[model samples]
Target: MSNVISAKNLTLAYDNGRKEIIKNASFNIKKGDFVFITGPSGSGKSTLLKSLYGQLKPKEGNLVVGGRDLANIGSRQLQELRTHMGIIFQDYKLINEWTVAKNVVLPLMIAGYSLDVQETQAHRLLKHVKLSEHADKYPLELSGGEQQRVGVARALAKNPVVILADEPTGNLDDYSSNVIWDLMENACQQLETTVLVVTHKIPTIFSLPYRHFIIESKGVYEVH
Candidate 1:
């Protein structure tokens, strides 16, 4: 398969390069691959994930996602690139004012789908995420796990080519975490969506062949 994400000699830093996180790290993730990036707190796992989604530019070297080189991408280009990607955050990032279905409809709305089409997709995706009963509920009314499930549904609503999840199950119970993992795994296997997740631990019950990478001491290494 073709590479969906590629990093060559990548160096990432923050605060005007005063805080260097990753240094000279290189890796490639192929299309339709399920990848887990693990590291302890302060290890730069999130930093690497941020770079993949264009939230952080490389301090040095080349980083590419969906064939777009992030090193010199413009704001307009970055916005365009994000439309094709699904991103799930640790905090769920749902708009409290919007109901669950509406939140899932946001991406389709942004993509200019008709209201009818948007609602249809929202309903379909919410069902897939097993949140159909809670579609009309506000985000604040749900539990942490339910809120994150909404986030996952929203991310998949656009049928994105790749999904980037940063510590997606960091605050969930085992059952909830497994549900989230199953949804992502299904996307990878059924829809051929590439998934790259940053987390402190990889669930031992994950029952699929996947690539594993770990961040340590300012470098990234793949585990066999």
Candidate 2:
């Protein structure tokens, strides 16, 4: 399989290079691969994720995603690249004013889909996430897990090639976390989506094969 994400000698720093978080890390994630990146607090797991989505530029080395180089990508080019990616955050970033269904269809709206098509896709995704009953409810009205479920639905709405999740299950209970895992696994298996998740713990419920990497002392290593 071809690589969907590639990094070579990637060095990430902050405060104008005064402090470096990830140094000389190299890895390649192929299409349809399910990857888990784990580390302790302040270990730069989230920082590395940010680089993947173009939120943080590399201080050194080459980084590529979906066949586009992020080293010196312009604003317009970066925006175009992001449309093919789905990002899920630990802190569910849903619009409070929009209803659940509307939040889920935000991507479709951005892509200029008609109202009918957007509503149809949203309904299907809401059902998949088991949140169809909460379609009209506001995000704040739901529990943390429910809100995160909506976030997952929104991320999958666009049928993105790669899903980048940062500590996706950090604040969830086992049941909810497993629910999220199942949805992501289905996306990988059925939809052929590449998934890269950064978490403190990789749940034991995963039945499919996956790749695990750990960040420590400013280096990334594959776990067997």
TM for every model, in the order presented, reads 0.98, 0.98
lDDT score at residue 221, model 1, on the 0-100 scale: 99
lDDT of 2 at 172: 92
Model 1 — TM-score against the truth?
0.98
Q: Residue-wise lDDT of candidate 1 within 1-224, one digit each (tens)?
A: 89999999999999988899999999999989999999889999999999988989999999999899999999999989999999999999999999999999888888899999988898899999999999999999999999999999999998899999999999999999999999999999999999999998889898778999999999999999
Clashes of 2: 0
- Per-residue CA lDDT of candidate 2, range 1-224, in tens? 99999999999999988799999999999999999999999999999999999999999999999888898999999998898888999999999999999999998898899999999998999999999999999999999999999999999999999999998998898899999999999999999999999999889879989999999999999998
